[model samples]
Target: MTALRFPALAGLLLVALVGISRPQPVAADTPAPAGFAAFVDDYYAALFAWEPNQATYAGIHDFDEKLADLNAPNITHRADVLKKLHERLKTLRAGKLTADEAIDAETLDHAIRAELLELEVVRDWKRNPVVYLGKPAEGIDMLMKRSFAPPADRLKAVIGRLKAAPQLLGAMKTNVENPPKEFTDLGLIVAKGSVSFFRNDLPAWAKDAAGKDKKLFAEFEAANKPVIEAFEAAAKWIETELLPKSKGKYAIGPDAFVKKLETEEMLDVPLDKLLAIGEANLKRDQETFVATAKKIDPKRTPAEVLATLNEDHPKPEDLVGATRGTIERTRKFLVDKKIVTVPSEVRPTIAETPAFMRTGGFASMDTPGAYETKATEAFYYVTPPETEWEARRKVEHMRQFNKTGMDIITIHEAFPGHYLQFLYAKQYPTKVRKLYTCGTNVEGWAHYAEQMIVEEGYGDGDPKVRLAQLNEALLRDCRYIVGIKLHTEGWTVEQGKKFFVEQGYIEPETAFQEARRGSYNPTYLYYTLGKLQIYKLRDDYKKAKGADFRLQTFHDEFVRQGGLPIKLIRKIMLPGDTGPTL
Candidate 1:
């Protein structure tokens, strides 16, 4: 579990939209070709039942009152289910399906295989304590953050999840044996954060609901204590016991890592070749950044220019407003330039970063699932500097939200990015497509959006804006290289931090934060890696379409495929082509 990773009101409509493409659950006995759609619906229903928190987040709230059963038996049961589903999927020949169903078949098959790998091989739950802690905190947070249901109804769900929370910790005590030191350390951070979440943030949120029903409130108050104490105890256990005996290793090693790339993302490139591609991309971005900085002010050094850009930020008071301010402008640009369809006319609701999630860098999008019913609000979260931070630390943190940086981040997180992507998720061709997504497709699209907008003239030729965009690219570029090195080459987080500072040009404090994030999230390289793939695909797509190539048309089609990997996207767009993704 992580310390970080939230509400709704005013909206009266409860959108009980289920199964993205189809209105009802797929029938079990339905035959193939046409039945492929039913298979997807069945797979999602089963998957969401196993992951109730995800179900809630996805806008299906039937399971909102239950947390996942993380004990060995339940875990094995779910894995066994996936195994059966895997075999069942194989029985239906993709060769027999229609064009669209064939893609869905391949995607659903890949998704099942990927989960089995994590369950059987990667097994982070058995090795990583953070998984145990993160899930509950995220689960409850989902309950509180959205206004899908009434406060009373949501609070009841919270109470139910809180009661179930203790079992999660007990399972952790049994399941997470010897974790990596980093895993233990990060687990403690999140566990402690969860403690704060329950004690302060949770009660404040529950008060209104409690106020409405004193008995229900008392019940919630009664139930909330054990969950808070459970998290606190888990944090203590991690600090005292797990940290001392953490003999667990973090690296998946070369073979497992390669298989992860191939099985999950359908990319079969060698690690060294992947690294070379990442490095080449980084070099180009760094050079462009330096050149852009020089253009901003020829007399100053590149680093000095970067510092100036960092300093050109919103005051702590203005961070959310600054982020909010970017939306209309970005949306207008996308529409005016025809960059992509605005799936819906709606704008994302901008809000402050949740307290627990504030430990990481500022900004994230909490999108309601396309099929989200009750809590339909999609939040664009921006973290402000902590009031307790020293002036220097505050300045460093705020630098990340500098004028141009805000523009670039806004591009990535909102307009023509995640929020936009979320808008289209439901309308995709298949149910499985709406549920399963790879980081390469998800983060890659966001990262690529940052660059694509600037290239499409969002920058208006301001070198500083271009520099800010490049700096963001450089950070992701560093993640690409650092993820590869830390996981494969035994580089320490400290070494990764130095690389971020020297090569990525990120400030030291933020640089360390990014590096530590890599320790836990190694596949983050998908941002830059995915961006590169999208670029290649776009070029190939343009070549194929020739005069038919409209940038907006390309983007509209790309996002419409849901968050499938670029390789799968290539099959749909550049039909029958199996060229390299990069």
Candidate 2:
């Protein structure tokens, strides 16, 4: 039997161990393939040993005794391993492998290539030492706070890693001895938020798991004090030394940005094409917004209507209650319309955004990771209104957080969206398909879901709700334009911010934040780009299926493909001689 090469799978598993064990036999009659299954099993074993915190997150406790080494030597060693694995995969013949084995091999190939690309093409970690230096070496802490593992197990992992916290800090210091100033500045900002993971959240978990593990709390407090000190030192270094020297520019220029776009997203189109798509979507969504605005108030123009919507928005009397009400209403709409079957496993909870994660956005969904067997749940985290703000500023912020906006966010971040899609993804059998999630498909589906549900008349004739939905879509469209323009078209931060305010209809402060974030996160474009790809794929699939193409059936099948790249979606949906072009 030919040796089925799966170095790619090994590479991905190495990053953060998902719940892939041995490759189960294809069926009873078809015996397990020889080399391929062995490759997968061996890869899983190595992964668990190397990254115990990762294993714990995946619900595998065999390696709960150790933690990942974020030290320089370990990072170098892993890079070397990835290089060897990529070479090994290149030597294997895919045609000789079994059908299932071939799929695994293909996935492995993609993963290895991606890792190699990251190492070769991306030099941010090395060039901007502050980026690495500023990061908290508390994967265990993160896993615990995220509730990826049981409280007891998470506590144990935290204690184990805490014992090595000094060494991790030493390694970080060594790595950042000559770090870039920009990295240090950003690192300081991120680090200031770090201690809260232990100071506030860890104690809550300890209280919850009190009777089960008495020693856990003591161990946590003992280990955390030193870790907090080290983080404080790192933060000081970033603020004092790094920020002063941060002469480095954030953008990587057109060529690097294009390569990053392709590498990160596996997108085929150039940056200009992406910008064009964004512009088109912005125009389309704006028209929809205008029409909806007219419905809300025929006398007012779209711009005037938008201003009125903002003017009549609510005060912050009971924020959580208001957001929860929106969620319940959205769930009812999904069920009533029969838009798609929501799995019983879909349960969404509203929570305050963790301080560490608030840098990313005002709200985000914490979907169940691939390895989770528990019912897929999501966290619709709303960042708490700023406490120190004066009454007027506070009220203005509250006005920004209206019921219409919350409903739009709920539809995008929860029901019939990320949580629902994730529940469907859990049903996919292939480890490669399940583990290697496509961000485009994931975010895109949620973005598309927001508009899709709104178009189906979800908000009980409330044009404010519909207007908010279009505004969100427009925000994503602005992201795409700003992302491409900042990186590929040499647009400055000021230009990007202006474009957001003008084209996206976003507030100046929000636009500024969005533009700044785009400099570092080029992948933000995935929201609109992914939606467009899915929409195109659906239209083509519908035409091909002819009379059989029910919307729910199409949505069910599309999501069942397990968040594969849209390029691969066409292959799965239309599997014949003439497949859709990339």
Candidate 3:
């Protein structure tokens, strides 16, 4: 059998005339070699069905009314389904497919392996108590934040998820045991934080919601009240039961970490080698930071110079407006420097970070899914200090969003950073590339943009601005080093924090948070890892293209390849060149 062409009727007729109907038309619907496209389509269908909330966020509304079935049986069922897909993928001949299809094949295969590792190996759902809190919080949040659907329609989806919330969380009492103390504490924080999302944000959003049937409101009240109550109970359980029994161990170990790096990022480098690379970068940046500080003010140390920059921050009332001010200046810098083709002139809308999101970071960019053609508004969110925080604490927090820091933040989150990357993501040539993003690719581009902008003279030789950019880079570089040592070298949380303060030039308070983040997120190193890979890629890309390699063209081409591992990007961009990813 050569192939089954589309127009099902015609293919069926042709198959019948050939006298081979034993396997049934459905199985024979696609022939072996030419069926790659159909095979991919089936994979996407299974993906969306298995991860419906993901689909909803991706703007594939077909699964908008569904939530993932977290019950053990359902998880096993999906895992089995993916296992079969992985086996089937092996039968396809890479030489027979188009280049794009071949790359998609690799992306889908990598994604399958990563998910299986999470389920069968890493298994956060079973070990991490915070899994229970974070999932539902994110699920409800997406429905609330996006206007992709009206409140009434989105409400149904939210209610469906809420109805399932009790059992899913309840199952955790058995499923999660001996989680790390950090996990339990964070679970408590996220759980406590969720109450506000339900009590305040949900009600406020639904207050003027259209099509508010009394019956629907009753349904929502019934679902919301209990789930909110259960959320509190879950937090109490983490504190009471889980905390006493909570272990201090959170490392996934060298074997699992290496597998994750190879599977998720396609990097084969060992942990020791990765740490060495991180240290080298850290040393270089630290030297430059000090040298730059001397230029800013000869009498002050680098930390003192950074503090002075922080002191020049915006007041509480001007936070959002101050962030909005950075947009045009950064964009104009990019254009004038010919750093990259921006692909868009429209700036992302400035917004205060949502209440639920403020717990994590000072600022970030939230863009619609690549496939989302409507309601395409992207937001650059600045997390303002909580109103109830002490005036001194508020002042302390505002220092992070200082005018220079805000400029670098906007460059990282907007300008030629995440927002710009997503704009290209929407235009990526393949569906798999559009949907399955590698963290290194996504974050690395943004992180790389920060340093690249500085090198291109966005700050006009201002030592303070250069110091701010290096500060961000040093933070990532520390994460890169600490992540390996904390997980693979039997280092404690205290050790990680000390490393940050010593190497990252961060304060004790912020260092603790960064170190704790490394405890749960061993892969936070991606910011530095990805940046290094892009830098390497640019060097080789520049070498390959010779005089033809325009910086703007190189950047445009890089994002166009979508969020694949730098190794995969190498094959695409530098074609036929088999090389290490830095």
Candidate 4:
């Protein structure tokens, strides 16, 4: 997840509504209560100040020079501060607020509670080493990737973070207790990759951004040197010290997991019922997979048909270009088919994945935050096989980027997916919605787009395309089951991996990565969960509109509502209807 910041309600209220192709004025016309607004402003200002990396991502620059204070005292103090804020929020008179104000108030309350849970209950700071090790590069990368400021200005922020990296790493060394071996392994990947990032990749970026400024170079060198050493040392420590004894439990336990869903997604379903829902979806998708494969080539097994599709892939050298070629075509499909409205013609640049992030990431969309104005460029990164890999291994990896799979991925990541959804950030109803988001709402929409486009006939009804779409859906379905089982049912990572291969029918390498992700992100089920929720919402919306319903209108309104939990979204879209989210 990208780090982000929030603004005061009054500051948010001052901005005029940015016109879109079709605007929906969802926020209340009246101003919020002054005391409530002030409380929100002070809370967000404190929040951004405490977590500066998030500030940078929110398009706020004031805290760019600082890193999160990870000292034990500061950590304890922050928790106390949040507790006080929570109390203050509870004291606010919600009934007197405007409609938008009430909604935002709830959103803000949920966010604060979620953070409190992490800091006080989950205590990832003490249990998860990746929390500290992953921040330095990520914090700097946010500053580096977007040219929001002049190179000199951004370099200054970079140098500041570089200097602060040692402290953060020190916190990692001192604070992280007995995390799961999986957690340590994940930390090592980031810590070691960051070593290369600081050593080889970061200097090149600094040199380009710094240009001919010799003094800036010296400052960067001084700040950056210790960061590299610190990472290298931290990596070795994790390898030798932590990994050997890293035997702590990874699961947050069933109750904590359920509470997480309640707070994060407003999902209150029981664990068994939720798992049953996921399993049901998986079974349906698997049946579709088998049927679709028969249409593609009846003689071949479903896996064999997928392997045949894999043979039609781009050479590794052309991977990025091949992906770039899909954007306009896919955008055109959205427009021609009326699948969804493409608000901005500005296309995201297709680029290779950053060296540091190429480990498990295959393709991803990186968009600017809601409040961003200066640096608006979005990136769609596609990872190509490394040069050092054997020809057979490289070929195996390239199969993942086969034409049909790439098209589905592009749909999921770019056109009418994440990139398209983010284009509506300026139109979000309130500041609270802009500041925070629901994962299911975000990932659900993207995953929904993949199936929606195909259902609208993107590939002339080619069964291969349908199979590819099912393949993607099955992966998410597997994530839904694996995530729940891994955490709540005592399933091993190996068991999860096998399920991915046998049930999801995914590549073994990708399955391993997905399983590893489930260990840490136990709620990675959001993709399928969210998608199913959207499908239900759409169906309900269609029934309500009847003859008046238009697909594009439903989509535009959905995107405009911002990334609230689908439950909250349903309340907004289908007033007074208390239907289940499933």
Candidate 5:
């Protein structure tokens, strides 16, 4: 069947897509006008100053000593600046710019408008308490994560941020009113984890980093005291003041949800149509899951077959070693099959998930920002089952990292997934493309890799491997349906959880977490949504190239475009194709 293509829905994307011309060769003496390029540079300069923590993460250390001034007036002023930038961007003619620069302009324009939506319309700063608690904690962690600078230098920046936490939390207390109960719960979790980070984990690191600098150590102690107290107070206030009043609905409603898709992903499908697509995909993956399970064992039910796979996981003591082995094997397979270019020989450090990040999930890829240079180490964090949990609870957690599933997880998190994509960051053409990423282009690519590799014979046509791949796909399919239903159809969390268990074949415990995450993270359906878009793009590109096409060539071109919306990338790769991206 021919895949469906979505039209550009929002006025902004239409403006962005206007005068879309092919790239023409320019003589060395006759360069394109610097108007667009100069504005991009100036815009990021202003952005770095306005949001200092963002700068730190981008490896710009000039702003490392400060946190963002998130006071209401400053936020208003920042939005005002972005509004003017958006206007200025619309004036630039795409005909006058280079092909790459025009796409960068579109990316930057979308990013600006999206920021405006958050600041003016959605307003998470005023609604979600997690924004306050999570941002500051993340700021410190970013500094600590890599040795971007000398220990003393990074500690100094950490102290500077610590001193500013009280004001940030004060803004949180003032701005946050009646967020959803799930958001409040998240805020409380962040607050408690933040307090623990400051009180326990931080001081131990500080002592080692501070060394013999008595004055610096004393200053660190002084700054850290108030930050700990502030988080403690924030947690208390959330429980007593916020949770009781957290009666706000998590739904952004149909209109805002549609608008979010347009602004963030340049997608314009209607909610009912989008939901229909998700539902159809869910049914498809569920049927595949049952058939694949039967191939593994015809006598057993699908759930019973999955249970046997779960028992194939490593014990707690062997978890890290087992994961490390899979990473090498996956990397080797990609190179051996010539699946895609592995630009670097460097491997990501496989480690236990840090204390602050272990609230949920099994494994993740934590790569440095594109602009980050000195501290370029990427981490593939796999959270082991906690020792304190009862044996049954531990068993349930370990099932997530079962050997067959871990192969899929490793591929998603490392080889030719996020870590592989990061290697091409320096090659991205523009600063705007480097800085701005849409979820569809990023997470979508990783999810797509899971199926692509399996289809290409990663597991050598093993039914167990095929079932594991389908298992992961079903989880993402469920996310697509549940995310839309929760926000647009007014489905309750329990309803969403039940859908995961029955349709996705997920365990009830993990199902509850995935459903709750949708309340706070409404657009997570991007995993499946993005994978489908890429598949559509690949199918179209293959027809265009026909005899000359190579799978490696297509994969290479996709990531080289950086993380623009797949729609914009479709325009870049297949310039004249006015088709839907499904």
Candidate 6:
């Protein structure tokens, strides 16, 4: 349910293609058709101008001098821009354009609509500004890791942004002056994490770059001093001014939440229908967990079996080694099983999660975006155990990295999952589909991959592995229910945490962390929901194809179509016109 409020299509477009270069102008072909290319060019120009940070990420240097103004006033201004863009896009006749131009038009049309839908229909910003917590840090992190600029040039940009830190903090204060107490408290947590970017992580990055660019490194350190102070000051403000005002009630309520479900997720099903599906899946997963647990230890109850299994799994001595082992084993399993095709360009490395980008979600895979070429390609970042945590808390935190959980995470983040999906997406022929991949499709596929591999007899014929996979799915299913209920069903945070701990079998601290995450990310439910759709799709496709269907063939075909929405995937696979529309 992570409710990120950034410009949508712009970000997707920036990251759509991995290695594509800027197109060279071709010789005149019927004068490039009337007003079509001009329209597309103008649309992109307006977009980049409005969102310069997006351009920087896209490797388009045309707007490097500017950063987006994400304050409330600018959000309104951007909303107006989106409205106008949508209107203009609607005026263009698709039939009048060439096939390529037509596709571009449709892409622009969808992008424009998606932007407007987010601002006007979703209105997430009005409900919560906690989405801003990791944004500034993400800006810094992306520029450092993903951009094509030289270390000096990149450091220069970092220094420039660092100089603006105080101003940015001031704007943030003004923006959230009347924010919900819950959001403000969350903001403080995020700010504390964000400050680590400057106080701790950046120094290491600066040291790495210092060998090649000493002057830039010096400037970076000097500039970061004020930025670090500003972040600290902001954190203090959250404790004092913001946290006190964070209380009272701030639910979207059932009606608005339902509207959001219908529009934002494009879910046509009613709340009860969705709940029914969730309940059914929950029951099924629990049964599988129980049955599998019985196989491992017949004398124990399901919960007792889980406890016994947790005790039996390997526990690595160090965090890095633990994560590395999980990743390597999962990658090798996929290759050995031939479950999914691995890309030659794949380079899945685990790294410490940067401070600035540490809120809203736990772990994320940063696949190379469309315009990025010759950059550090992919990373699976795991948040380090916080140093300030007490001994018991630290132990609980480390338990999150238990061997089985780490393996499950590796399945989601790397092998036959996100990294693999992105590799095939890079080969997709259509730029529009490639540019705007669906989260449900991408995340769902990974979630499905976790269970698929285990069900297909991975882990050396151990049912415990399958049990672990189901437990992970159970956690996600609980996320779906909790996320919807908390945001729309008037369930309190405590209630949500209770649901996580009681039903999902999650630890107390983990439950609290997940509940807080659901505050802003109501649609985080899509990981499991999407995975369920993919699984159902596979079953239906297999039945339809009868004896001809093969798991590898189905998987290859499914992924090769780009990460289209499952609705569109239905049309692609079933070959019928009555496809579900977003």
Give TM-scores for every candidate, taking all chains together and pairing residue i with residue i.
Answer: 0.92, 0.85, 0.91, 0.93, 0.92, 0.87
- Predict model 6's lDDT versus the native: 0.66
- Model 1 worst lDDT window (10 residues): 1-10
After superposing candidate 3 on the true structure, give the runs of residues whose Cα lies further than 4 Å from its correct spot.
Answer: 1-34, 93-95, 387-396
lDDT of 5 by residue, 511-543 (tens): 887898889778889989999999999999999
- Off-target runs (Cα >4 Å) in candidate 4 are 1-34, 387-393
Weakest 10 consecutive residues, lDDT, candidate 5? 1-10
| CA-only RMSD, every prediction | 3.9, 6.3, 7.5, 5.1, 6.9, 4.5
Tens digits of per-residue lDDT for model 1, 305-372: 88877888889998888888888888899989889999688787888876666556678887776456
The global C-alpha lDDT for each of the candidates, from Candidate 1 onward, is 0.79, 0.63, 0.75, 0.81, 0.80, 0.66
Per-residue lDDT of model 6, residues 1-582, tens digit only: 122222333122224333233332222232332465555555555566666565555555544444556677877877776666555556666347765455456556656656666667556555444455555666667667764677667767766666655665766776655565667767787788878778888778767756677777787888888878988888888888777776645565666666555443445777787888888888888888888888998998787767655554333235666677776688787777777777654466777666555553546676555455556456777766567767666565555565666677778877777767667755665655555555567778888888888877778768777777887888888888988888777888789899988887776777887886777666677778888788878877888899998888888888877666676676667664353432
Query: What tens digits encode model 2's per-residue C-alpha lDDT throughout 1-582?
Result: 000011122111112234354322122233333466555554445555555544544445555445556676766665666655555555554436765556556666656556555555554554454344323443554455455456676667667776665565566566544444434555665676676665667667666754456676777778878877777786776677766766666666777676655654567676666667778888988888888888989998776777666666554546666777877788777778888877664366777766655453666665544555442345567665556657665654565566678777777777777667656765665666655555577778888888888778887668788888887888889988888887767777789899888887777666776887777665678888888878888888889989988888888888777666676667667775254332
Model 3, residue 538: C-alpha shift (Å): 0.9
How much is 291 displaced in model 1, in angstroms? 1.4
Worst 10 residues of 6 by lDDT: 1-10
Q: Who is ahead in TM-score, 2 or 3?
A: 3
TM-score of 6: 0.87
Q: Pairing residues by index, what is the TM-score of model 1?
A: 0.92
* Candidate achieving the largest lDDT: 4
* Candidate scoring better on lDDT of 2 and 4: 4
